[model samples]
Target: MLMTTNEPQSILDRSGMTNAEAGALYRLLTWLSPSFPVGAFAYSSGIEWAVEAGDISDAVSLRGWLAALLADGSGFCDGVFLAQAHRAAETGDDGVLREIAELAAAYVPSRERQLETTTQGRAFIEIARAAWSYDGLDLLIASCGGTIVYPVAVGIVSAAHGIPLAPTLHAFLHALASNWISAGSRLVPLGQTDSQRVLASLEPVVAATAGRALLATLDDLGSATFRADLSSLRHETQYTRLFRS
Candidate 1:
């Protein structure tokens, strides 16, 4: 049975969010969920090679690797792109949005890395358009043209649906960290508790990365995680592999 209430106090919680805000939050949760069918699990973002190379054999090392990624590598670069795309879409500036999308597509460091982001990017656009779209989501995506980078796709969708960028950035980074941590868990064969510990330890790194990305401009996009980049390249020819990248 459903109970209807006219009182805002009765319907709303201490957070004081209106129904629109609450619904927007729910959409973010759904779009970024691990089971959202974007094939995120198929890509490890180089964790597979990191494990094989013994760079991530334990929780502490795993945390460190991810911290670098969040602070200086794809995490930071992608976040910048995401923010740019979000603001561009929010302002109805397709020119800026298209440029950001192109940069993200060209920013990948390896063949498989490009495959990983763009493949998921295409899937996210198609899935969201089919099930969760607004009037402008498809238009923004179509305007961007060519291969849509995943972060750009996410940013566009977030803006199109009126989801605020701060929480969206945090959630997006958190989800990326979670997926990579999951890959690390399987490859390192870590106990479930250890995996949780690794993820727990990355909170500050993710928060700081999201904060930087919130203020970042396209000019700030770059990466210095050379070893991590090599891992993605090495994964291409590794004798045995379980991840796409």
Candidate 2:
């Protein structure tokens, strides 16, 4: 979606950006920073359920679960949606963007998964509007007639702000993986050292998944994390749960 090449080009100079590249980097940091008010801490994406079910009881199990998730599950599906939405926003194709938004909202396999995306998406939009307003962003918002998903909302905003696609997608996937790792840390009762180790081990997988997502299309969107999907559905009625999803 974003016109990109393996060759390294100075985005600051190539895009005619008046500010230094540091400004763009800072924007990405702030937007994706853990302190950002998307309420990501409230949802576990079914990791809590997985923990309770003993599917993720240790660092090794957690890492494997997250790897599968990043490689072929919601992570892959969301990446395709984000890339498509970003392309639509970049091209000023409101119709395509709207269609993508609706499709993304409907793509989730369970009710909690739906809430997980839509709630965070609504929060992300509202906070971004108040903190970093832009003409292109406002246009995208006006065109989204129904509920928006988190990845689609983020894609539209990132594109509107002139952020490059590959790094944006990579950062997004990394952030999600980190969040899941954090959830696993708490749910698994792993120490900080073990948590960091798990995160470190997942770097290669994260890179591989990001590279795959960059070249993936909407037709490639599908989930093979059968247990993960079942876990999310099971979490709906889970007793004594620690996460919202």
Candidate 3:
């Protein structure tokens, strides 16, 4: 049987949309782009403190710090939140979405960390609303009542726009790693080549975290990077600072 170009051949077809026009790759790239104006470059996520404390003084140390984050720290927690929020959005569960947002906001271990996520989250929502406005995301933001966490915002928006969950989480983690690497580069004074090498070595960690996050729930969320959390708190009082947190 000959099928028309727009006709579905199987029940797996969703909304008669073709994979070629799904726009997942383009949306992910644009939303995560450095120039997206979410102010991602202005925050260090405590890398500033880590550098000052000599915890991340070289490319090797930087990789280790980020690996912990990806494997079992803020990255792990955020990835879980992102996945749950994505599921909530996918299921049209405003209650679950709100719960996730509230929990994520309250889970931060320090004031600076809170500021980092909330501030960036607000900025991300603003840009997304202004540029990539969508009803699902609009409702999610409206439902949050002005307190959305960064990962939640990213998750809701991605799910609302039909970006698959795993890739969205992967892109989120990669964007995070890239931002931290940029900060480490300036702080550790690593050359461009070394920075690239560090990111390359951590690819497996990022992939593994994303995979785990896809199947993880709130129960799976936890951070073992106590010192890293402390660095964020300490960064709040660090006399000199190049980044916000």
Candidate 4:
């Protein structure tokens, strides 16, 4: 039997490839920056509903809710969408990209969720195009023919900029989880330290999820019955809500 190493040792060994290292850093910083203007702060992704419903009123429930969402719902959906978008962009198929965008757009069950995906997605693409100046990115923007979904924009920009899918997707998932956790902290009135502890506990989930998502295909884009969707739907009618979605 023979064993093989899958590491990019050759690429890591090159000292003159500072551009590659810088590019990765830049992408990471941009994706994680609170100022990226993805409108992530405005939408709680149904967390507000969960909090109001008392489903996630404490740190324990908050952690559990977030974990389930990341493991079974949006995390999986986004992973598949990201991969499909990457493949579409790689092939330079505008139709495929549009289809991918539509599929992602339709996956969200609630109107609020749909709005969040499209709104953040369009902003993300516009910002990336204006700041990064990548080749295929412009084509993707034009091909959108309308507003692009968030996962699709992420996939396109990541692939166009030569960023690996795993890291980009992982960062996106982590940021999402972090945003929810931040919301939980505010809603549950959990201390800042407890929030950090909860986030630390999610590190393993993020790492394992990223590895799993790397192997995921379009066939794997399904959601579990988490009740969060129902919460989001109900949020649309909630009278005195602090968050948009």
Q: What is the C-alpha lDDT of each candidate?
A: 0.91, 0.87, 0.87, 0.81
lDDT of 1 by residue, 32-110 (tens): 9998999999999999999988899898999999999999999999899899999999999978778888888999999
Q: Write the per-residue lDDT of candidate 4 for residues 1-245, one digit (tens) a residue.
A: 89775446545556454558667767767866766888888888888888888898777888888888888888767877887788778778999888777777778888888899899998888887787787667877777567678888888888888787777888887887888888788877799999998898888887777777778877777888459888889999987787889
Residue 30, model 2, lDDT: 79
lDDT value, residue 243 of candidate 1:
88
Full-model lDDT, candidate 1: 0.91
> Best candidate, TM-score-wise?
1
Minimal lDDT window, size 10, model 2: 4-13
Off by over 4 Å in 1: 1-10, 13-15
Q: What's the number of clashes in each of the models?
A: 0, 0, 0, 0
Instruction: Rank the candidate models, highest TM-score first.
Output: 1, 2, 3, 4
Off by over 4 Å in 4: 1-17
Better of 3 and 4 by lDDT: 3
Worst 10 residues of 3 by lDDT: 6-15
Q: Which predicted model would earn the best lDDT?
A: 1
Quote model 3's TM-score: 0.90
Residue 69 lDDT in model 4?
Answer: 84
User: For candidate 2, lDDT tens digit of each residue in 1-245?
Assistant: 79766343455567665464556567777777778889898899999999999999999999999999989899888888888888899999999889899999999988998999999899988887787788768889777778999999889888888888888888888888888988888899899999999889988988898888788887788889999999999999998988999
TM-score of each: 0.95, 0.91, 0.90, 0.89
